[model samples]
Target chain A: MRISQLSAASGVPIPTIKYYLREGLLQPGEQTAATRAEYGEAHLRRLRLIRALLEVGRVPVTAIRQIIAAVEDETMPVHEMLGTAHYALATPVEAAADDDRHREALALVDALIGELGWQVTPEAPTRAELAQVLVRLDRLGRPASVEKLRPYAEHVARFAREREMDSVSGPREAAVESLVVGTVLYGKVLDVLRRIAHESESARRHTSGHPAAPAG
Target chain B: MRISQLSAASGVPIPTIKYYLREGLLQPGEQTAATRAEYGEAHLRRLRLIRALLEVGRVPVTAIRQIIAAVEDETMPVHEMLGTAHYALATPVEAAADDDRHREALALVDALIGELGWQVTPEAPTRAELAQVLVRLDRLGRPASVEKLRPYAEHVARFAREREMDSVSGPREAAVESLVVGTVLYGKVLDVLRRIAHESESARRHTSGHPAAPAG
Candidate 1:
């Protein structure tokens, strides 16, 4: 396929495809002649993944570049690749200026991890991100006690485990790409799903004086 | 109290608070004199809420104004207030150009909502957001069947119900503000927590050659 066909098939514009090619997001197609090149199925797949990350996942192009680099580098351990992808997707939270609140949040996160017996590294980017949320909650004078968040954490753990298992069942490269893409986009999916669920529950609670239907 | 005190209490910079005031996200303080105004507890709380939405929630000022307006409109039903907040927080997804794929994704979302008996409105922004994710998944050639996402939706429903219950225990205005703030921040919190859990699961799976201990 030529660039135009790739754009037509992928629903991306020709100039944007050229931009991606210039940015090295899409590898240069095979040089069939002086002014033309041929793209194969791999190029199409890569373009689709890039579009998903940029448009649906809302990942920045720089981050997408790092994620793609990790996926293509076979020497990088899959675990490390996954870490790269996770970091790329996570929006960096600014650290709280107050040391006391920051330390308190960190300690709370540490205790929660200890209680759950989850083997997360102390340096994981998410630890800081979670701590930042706790700090923000505290500053708002509506701190979320670990006890209050524990059940939700348990549910999150289950979801994460399911995601991990799901990532292991496909071809290695494709699985890695899917894992990264899925992690980013699934967060958005969950957000929308949760909102819909909230609407349902709100209707049930506000319209009637009874609890909602029993959980499945 | 005054603007500086509000800034100090809210931990928002004076310039940012002034910006919010100018943007109509914050109501003007009581006029004490031609050049000075006296801010009260309401101003302080509103300032704090604005800072939370802007700094932590990352909501645009235009959206924050609408959310603030919703919170202040006591005659607005709680359900409508919640809807406004959800709409303000949801990142809109652009529909795919392929009508067939878009329709298929919409049908899948409709079926999922019907199957779950969820009381989501046809115009709910999240319905479109969820459909967009499904479309992106299909474009990637790895469509997420509603059956595959059912258990996740069940869990999301439970979480949403918990959130709704949590929102109802405070003063009406404060509760509405908190709901909006919490919705945005909690989504970030959940993302980080899920990433941490994934790290834990990945560590256990790859390092020990066995699945992690049974999910609690």
Candidate 2:
């Protein structure tokens, strides 16, 4: 297939496809002639994955490049490849050096991890993210208790298990691609689902004459 | 206090505070003279909220304007105010005017809502969001089932209930502000927590020499 066909099939514009090729996000097609190149099924699949990450997952182009590099590296362990993808997808959370709030947030995260018996490492990007949220919540004078977050964590673990189950079936690279796409895109899915559920619960409580929960 | 003092108090830079004022995300301080204005505690609080929404929640300036408008509207019901905030926070999902995938996704959303006995309206922005995710999942050949999503929804409902509990404690306007802030920022919190949980679960399943779950 020519670049035009790849664009048509993938529903991406030709210029965008050319851009991805230049960015090395898409592998270069076989040069059939001076101005002609041929794409293949793999290119189609890769293009779709890139679109999913960029549009649905909102992953930055630079991060997507890193994720794609991991995906294409056959020697990278599946687990490590996954770690690379996850790290790329995470928004870096910055904290002030030597800030007490940062210290408190880190301690709270450590305590939560211990309480849950979760096996994550101390340096995971999510640790900083969790700390950032905790610090901000504390600043707002509504710090969250572990008791409040435990059930949510348990539920997330279950969802992760389900996602893992969903991603482990295909061939190695394909499976990794699926896992990367699912992890980033499905996070958006979960966010939307939760919002919908919140709307439903709010409607039931406020609009349907089911007496609103008493104000605290 | 002058705008500079408000900036000092909120830890938002003077230029960014001025930007927020220009954007109408923050109300003007009272004009005391030709070039001097006196800001009060309310200005300080509003500046903090603006920063939280922008920096922590990652809400766009335009959406923040709509959210702030809803927050300041005294006549808007509390539930309605919350609806405005949620709508603003949602990533708009555009579907073709006559697309089968769109229809199928809508059907799936309707079926899921009926199955769950949820009270959400058909027109909720989240309805479109849910449909969009379903459509994308289907395109990726990993269509999510109601069975898979139900547990996640249940967990989301629990989180929503907890959020409601937290928001009902303060004065009306303050409660509304708290609800808005919590809804946006806590979504980030939940995302980080879920990522952490996924990392932990991945480690336990793959890195600890435990037998991995069988691929589906």
Candidate 3:
């Protein structure tokens, strides 16, 4: 297939494909002639994964490059590859240095992990991210304790372990591509679903002759 | 209390508070003299909310302004205010005006809402957002049916209905501020929890001598 066909099939535009090729996000197609190149099925699959990450996941271009590198390295074990993809997609939380609040939040996060019996990598960015949100919630006086986070943790763990792991099965490249794409898309799916749920609940409460608020 | 006191109390810097005041994301403190303004407890609360939206939610500044305006419009009913805030925070999905894929997605979303007996607002941005995600997932060959999304929808809806609604209590401004802040931050908290859960699951599978993948 030519570049044009790859573009048509993948729903990606020609110029954008060119941009990706220039940036080495998409591996170069076989040079069939002076200015024409032939893209294969692998190219198409890779292109779709890149677009998914860029558009759906909103992973930065640089991060996408890192994820691609990690995925293509077949020598990497599945667990480490998932971690690389995870790290690439999740921006690190900016935990302040030498801050008492940050230390307290870190301790809480570690404690939560211990209590939940979740063997998160010592430096999984989500740990810091969770800690940061905990600190922020505490500041707001909402104060989400470990117990408060347990429900969310259990919900996602069941989904990831039961559904997500089962979802990633196929030949090596295909499995990896889908895993990388699913990693971000599934999260977005959850986010939109949550929003819709809130909208439904909001509508239900208001329509049931429930006044929205005491002062409203 | 002066702006300095507000900053100290909120842990926000003086210049950032000034910027928020200039942008009207924060209402101006009372003018006391040529170079002085007095901020009350309300200012501190609002400042905390604004930072949470900015840092935790990563909401664009313009969107945050719109959310602030909607939340401040005390006359608006709770449901409508929530709808307004939802619209403000959720960047609209770009559903192509005449794309068949989008049309099909829209129909699917409507059907899903109907099946769930959810009375979502007609123009709820999340409807389009959810539809778009379904389309994207389909293109990835991971077509998530309405059934596939049900579990996530129920999970989030339960959280919103049972916990989130009840969490919003207090005087009017306090209630509204917390609601707006919680709306975004809680989502972040859930997101990190999901990631942590995945990390834990990955560890469990790998440490128990599960091969990460076939060729890895």
Candidate 4:
């Protein structure tokens, strides 16, 4: 396929496609003439992944570049590739400005990790992100103690082990796509549904609240 | 206490705290003199929440004002207040660019809501959000059909009914705090934990293959 067809089929504009090529997000196509380069299914697949990350996940361009580098690095171990992809999804939370609250939050997070018996690295950004949330919750006087969050922790573990991992063993591109889309977007799927559930439960409590009435 | 003390207590800067007040996210303090005003504990609490939403949740100032307005409307029913809060957490997804893909995605979202037995409104923004995520996933050739997403939908429902609704029974201010923080910040918590779980799973698949080995 030519660049024009790729844009038509993928619904991405031609100039934006050129921009992606310049950004090294999409690989260059086979050179056929002075002004034209031929693309294929591979280009289309890559374009789609890039859009999903940028549009739905809202991942930063720099992080996406790193992730794409990993995807193109076919020789890289799948597990290792996933490590970088997961790490790149979140930008680092600013360190607690020497705030004592951070110390306690960090301790609380580490203890929770210990209780859960999960083998995670000490410096994983996600661990720090969790600690930051607890601190924020506490400052609001609506502190979510680890015990309060324990149930969620357990559910996440099971979801990751059973469902999220199911895709890890597929072909590299497919597997990477699963990790990128699943980690960021599906996390969203859960968030949006949780809101719906909030609505349903609120309706149950506030109104006569029959069972899940289908939307008319 | 004065605004300066509120700033100290909440760790938000004086200027930013005033911005919240001007934006109507914070209620005005009692005027003590031509140039001085006194704040109370409530001011402190509101400041913390504003910081949490802005710094951590990254909710826009406009949405924060709307949410704060809802929060301040003490006469507002809890269910109604929550409805607005959840809706405010996300801006509307662009109306599918008139792409035909949107129709199928919306149908799928409605079907999934039906299958899960969630009583959500037809016009709920979260419903539109779920549809958008699915559409993005499909474009990546990683269509997460209803079945694939069913488990998450069920998990979310259970989490909402049992855990999230627990907070709705609190005081109005506290309840609104939970809705805003829980919907936005805790959503990040889940996203982070899911990443951690991915790390552990990848470690399990790649390395020593131990259960969650504790961080050093």
Top-scoring candidate (TM-score) = 4
User: Which order, best to worst by DockQ?
Assistant: 4, 3, 1, 2
| lDDT score at residue A107, model 1, on the 0-100 scale | 87
Which segments of model 3 are wrong by more than 4 Å? A1-47, A50-76, A95-98, A138-142, A209-216, B1-76, B94-98, B138-142, B210-216
**Cα lDDT over the full model 4:** 0.78
> Which candidate, 1 or 2, would have the higher DockQ against the true structure?
1
Clashing pairs in 1: none
- Cα lDDT tens digits, model 2, A71-131, are 8888876667777766766777764664888888888887777787787766788887788
Q: Residue A26 deviation, candidate 3, in Å? A: 6.6
Candidate 3 structure quality by residue, lDDT tens digits, A1-216: 998899998889999999999999999999999998999998888887787677666779988787778778888777777776666667667747537877788888887777777777787887777788777777766777777777667777777776777766565556556666666777777788887887777677766654332211
Q: Name the lDDT value of residue A183 in candidate 3.
A: 69
Give DockQ for candidates 1 onward, in order: 0.38, 0.33, 0.38, 0.46
Enumerate residue pairs that collide in model 2: none
TM-score of each: 0.75, 0.70, 0.75, 0.77
- Runs in model 4 lying further than 4 Å from the true structure: A1-76, A209-216, B1-76, B208-216
lDDT (tens digit, per residue) of candidate 4 on B106-156: 899888878766777888887778888888778666777788888887887
Query: In order, how many clashes per candidate?
Result: 0, 0, 0, 3
Instruction: Evaluate fnat for each of the predicted models and list the values in order.
Output: 0.58, 0.58, 0.63, 0.65
- Local distance difference test, candidate 3: 0.75
What i-RMS does each candidate reach, in Å?
4.1, 7.5, 7.9, 3.0
**Candidate 4 chain A — worst ten consecutive residues by lDDT sum?**
A207-216
Candidate 4 chain B minimal-lDDT segment of 10 residues: B207-216
